[model samples]
Target: MAINIMLATAMQPLGFLSAGWLADWAQPHTSGPGRGAALVLLASGVLLVVWGLAGLRYRPLRHLEDLVPDAAPPPEADADLDAVQNRVLAA
Candidate 1:
């Protein structure tokens, strides 16, 4: 989640740089096609960054079973596991 946030934040600067370059290259035409393109890129970049931050809000919990912290298999299950291990070792 943190990594995603960082990446999305990174896109903002990249989008700005690209838009600046395009606007400069367009010169007088910048107010026409270049400006429109820059606006689109800027908007899209902002959306990406916002989306990444939203991911943090939806991250899953690591431990769902909070009622029992020391939960374990029954003793019978442990004994069966041991028996299986012993048979494998003997073979």
Candidate 2:
């Protein structure tokens, strides 16, 4: 869970950098700023489509829900509080 949080936090800046790089690359090939924006949108859409198709093609990805079991339900709030209180009293 900690690693997941760290990776998610790290990805935000990387996402911004990639978008900026894509815009720069598109700017050179297109006519104006507006055209560059359009190109970026087109490229992003293409990438999404390709990603979706790949997910569908991959068996494990396509059946992700079946591949992984659901997490156990969390302990009840009162149960957790009681356990903490008992530990404090024991200490």
Candidate 3:
């Protein structure tokens, strides 16, 4: 939950920064808005290709399924209040 919150908080600012960078990069080279859009698309494609190659080269990423353990099932809920209290006290 905390990790998700942190990621959500960071993503918007990072997005704005990337958008600013793309605008700065595309503005000088392109004549029109359409050209700038095309440049952004081209940049995205290149980034995707690089990301794919990186995933291929990284061994841990490739073996992630084997490395990480599956989550344990949750404990069953106790209905009786006295029994629950006793278990809690014992623990």
Candidate 4:
């Protein structure tokens, strides 16, 4: 969709900002810039692979309703308080 494309396009600057923050604040002194760069590269590669797989799939893997039942009501609470009151009266 257009919205997804727009958001993906806007992510470039955010990614740059995150990379800069990682380089400045999060990166370790001993491991240095190379390690920081490697992490960023690995993360980007993973994102690309996931995005490609999702894009290639024409239909949803499964519908939301297929995963969860819509009509079944939630379980009711117990009558423990009533039982406690009855026990107190009998005692």
Candidate 5:
């Protein structure tokens, strides 16, 4: 977990740098062999980021909440129990 956090912190800046580079590469009035390669990179990066976020959508916190009960706070748990009891009685 610690290593993953550290690596992410380091790599986070690289993503920004890559975006900056791509923006510069594809800036208006610039022409070269791969005229739109930067745009391709931009699309690819966006896709990869979206994919990564989707993959970790439920585990960003990497906590027991994702895999266990007792996720609610104590006060909330009491309220939830009361609500359930009321529903059961009403039904």
Candidate 6:
């Protein structure tokens, strides 16, 4: 749940990131349409570098579960025993 929340928080900033990248790309680098695209491409390359440095620090949300797999199932009878013990102790 915390991982999902963290990802949601990160996603909120990505839109502004993408827009800023687009703006940088669309600006006239050399006063030509092709130059604009090239500038955008260059900006995108920088974005990739920045994202790699930051995002790589944490496994993306989809991959978080893979980082720590669920443990094996506990013994069913043991679980039942634990429940009964709790009830008796509570009483």
Report the number of the highest-lDDT candidate.
2
What residue runs in model 1 are displaced by over 4 Å at the alpha carbon?
Answer: 1-33, 61-91
Off by over 4 Å in 3: 1-5, 77-91
Indicate the TM-score of model 3: 0.56
| Per-residue lDDT of model 3, residues 1-91, tens digit only | 5996999798979867787578667877989766766788788789989988999899998898899998875454436777877988999
**Residue-wise lDDT of candidate 2 within 1-91, one digit each (tens)?**
6997999899889878788777787888888667776888887799989988988999987888897998876555447787877987999
Determine which window of 10 residues in candidate 3 has minimal summed lDDT. 72-81
**Per-residue alpha-carbon lDDT of model 4 for 1-91, expressed as tens digits?**
5997999899989888888676555357437557766776777799999987886673544354475666754333354777767877999
**Global Cα lDDT for candidate 4:** 0.70
Candidate 1 similarity to native, TM-score:
0.32
Model 3, residue 23: what's the lDDT? 68
**Per the 3 Å backbone cut-off, how many clashing residue pairs does candidate 3 have?**
0
The better candidate by lDDT, 1 or 3, is: 3
Off by over 4 Å in 6: 1-27, 58-67, 70-91
Best by TM-score: 2
| Candidate that beats the other on TM-score, 1 or 4, i.e. the better one | 4
Q: What is the lDDT of residue 9 in candidate 2?
A: 98
Candidate 6 lDDT over residue span 1-91, tens digit each: 8997999798978866786567565765467556665776677699889987786676575477788878886566556887877987999
Worst 10 residues of 2 by lDDT: 72-81
> Which lDDT values do the candidates have, in the order given?
0.69, 0.83, 0.80, 0.70, 0.72, 0.73
Kindly list the per-residue Cα lDDT of model 1 for residues 1-91, writing each as its tens digit. Answer: 5996999798889868787666565556546655756765676689889976776565453233454466686656756787877987999
Worst 10-residue lDDT window for candidate 5 reads 58-67
Per-model RMSD to reference = 11.0, 4.5, 5.9, 13.7, 9.8, 8.6
Sort order, TM-score high to low: 2, 3, 4, 6, 5, 1
Residue pairs of candidate 6 with colliding backbone atoms: 25-40
